[model samples]
Target: MSASDSSPELSSEIALLRQPGLIGCLAGRNLSAFSSQVQAVAVGWQIYALTHSAAALGFAGLAQFLPMLLLTLPAGHVADQFNRRRIVITCQVIEASAACLMAIASWQHWIGAWALYVLVALFGACRAFEMPAQQTFLPAIVPVSLFPRAAALSSSLFQVACIAGPSLGGVLYGFGADTCYALCAIGFAISALATSSIRLRFPARQRQPITLESVMGGIAFLRRQRPMFGAISLDLFAVLLGGATALLPLYAEDILHAGPVALGFLRAGPAMGAVLMAGIMTRWPIRHNAGRTMFFSVAVFGVATIVFGLSHSILVSILALMVLGAADVVSVMVRGALVQLGTPDEMRGRVSAVNMLFIGSSNQLGEFESGMMAAWMGAVPAVVIGGVGTLIVTVLWMRLFPGLRDLDRLDDIKPAD
Candidate 1:
């Protein structure tokens, strides 16, 4: 049945899933994320096994972050000026090639920690272009009225991949690193093909002259949109301070006395929670007090981080991580809806690029920070301290961004002028 012909009782999610383009986008996105997660597990295990240093993991994150920092802005402009779908396809192909190279290096017994870092940097470069372009896919494919539900459902599926990828990678790694890398290559290739199949509803874009001002347009836009700025920055600091996912390897092996499989489960824990929460949000989205809900969620994330940091039991650690993940998805959904619906279609790429930068900083840089702190003190102390910092940021941000704090509903956000 046609979407408009469907019964009024039909769920928004069911209608969204019926869209062929969104299906393709979700498939491609899930495959890409799954492959990346698998790569992460293998890289983390292999690097630590080779160097046995916490600092080495931090350096790994740094390797990825640097490329993103350098390329993301220009990449954003490219997304706005070029075919976003083509950009996504091309990036996936490049990533696939890099994964193949890594696999070959591993199989040849010539792969070193440095080689892995370089390949990871290559992956980072591709993602710099891929993300901004990819972010625009939903709004282009679906009506604005259906966007919030679409976003939640998309995140839910992505989290499912995140959960599966690490577990599969951990298992595959036991066979060999080459095997994991080979699978990652295949995943990226399929992702490229899947993305190529998408029919974008809005394919036209206005090309702007390259100037310093245009390049910095996203940053300027965010500055004026206090709610968007606050939500994005709040996430940046909260994740940067509270993240302990980077330390999972240490926790699984040293603290929990578990093996690679257990490590996989540990990695999947948060995704499990995230997917669950995303499902909940999809069915019953936050209708009121979105700003306050976001703040509360972040605070819960901080508390969960603290609990995970102090936990020695595997079950407890996983539970804490799940809570952390669940809390995080709430903030993610709220922020995603706020940013996407509030920004003009023309500026979506640039703004999403800025958003990607914040996310990359929080994740990659946070990993670096966790590693350094773990090296200086201990993993537990570093994680605990970071959690406390997250709490402080949460409180501070509530006071600082009252505009965001007072926000009542996602629908209340209007496109920036």
Candidate 2:
């Protein structure tokens, strides 16, 4: 369907599935996300089993985050300057190779803690290039009018993967870590194949010369787009402060006195809620009050976080987390639409890189902040304080970015010249 086609079918989720190239991109996204999640579970279990140290597990995450922190901008430059499809395919191939190596090492019983860290870091570096290129695919292949629905549907599929992958990984790990790694390798290989099948309707335009100025252009572009800056930064601070997922282990064992099964439920709660919300948005796309809705969603996220922090019941905590997840998906869909629709195609890679950086930072630093505060005072107090901090950030952002707050429609946002 064309962007201008306003038939009743245009509003349906089936319309997006029918779009040429979209199904391949969606398949690629789902497979890659599932592989990453499965790999995460296997790595965490294997790392702890090998070293029996919490600190080593922490280093594993750091190993992954560090590459994303260091290589994202340069990767973004490469995405804009080269064939994005080829970059995505190459990264997935690298990821498949890394997974294969991990499988071989696990089968040989020769995988050490450092080996796991090295492989995880390799996966991270590939993600730095893969994400920005993959992110551009939706906008490049779909009509602008269908972008919001497409984003929502995409999030739904990813959340499904997130919810399912760990459970499957845990089951496969009982067979052997090698078994898990082998499956991950297959997933990555299939993801690469799926992405290779897509044909971009709006291919990346190579416009900028190879210069420092060109590499840094996304930052400059974001600076001029006030709404985009506000929306993205709002997510950064809100998530940074309100992140309570890092404390789930403590909450399950200490606060709620629940066991590992409860912990599993707690982890899955948010993804379940996110998937539900994404499905709702896919069916009934946000047509008006786009900005206020986003702000309201963030506020809801803070409120949910606070509730989860104060809850002594696992049921209450899980419910709070579900609300938090639902709220977060709204903010995410809005911010993603704003970022993709407001920026020009040539700059989308760089801008998406910066966005990915903020997302990565928020997740890593949020965990650190939660752990520090939990150690300093207590888990309850740490999470409560973080939730309250999120509320304060939301209020402050509303005043600072009136343009975003007052914004009305996602389709109204035009690509900056």
Candidate lDDT (C-alpha), each: 0.91, 0.84
Q: Can you write out model 2's per-residue Cα lDDT over 1-417, one digit (the tens) per residue?
A: 576786675545567788899989999989999898778767876775676544454566677778999888878888887889999999999999999999999999999999998898898899999998888999988888788888989999988887777667767777888988999999999999999999875553646666778777788899999999999899989988998765665676678986544655677778878999998988887889999999999999999999999999988888898899999999999999999999888899899998887887676567666766776787788888889999999999999999999989887788997
lDDT of 1: 0.91
Judge candidate 2 at residue 279 and give its lDDT.
88
Clashing residue pairs for model 1:
none
RMSD of each: 1.9, 3.2
Worst 10 residues of 2 by lDDT: 52-61
Instruction: List candidate 2 stretches off by more than 4 Å.
Output: 1-12, 45-58, 107-109, 201-209, 249-262
lDDT for position 256 in model 2: 95
Among these predicted structures, which one has the highest TM-score? 1
The clash numbers for all candidates, in the given order, read 0, 0
Model 2 residue 296 distance off true place after TM-score fit, in angstroms:
1.3
Where in model 1 is the C-alpha error above 4 Å?
Answer: 1-9, 201-206
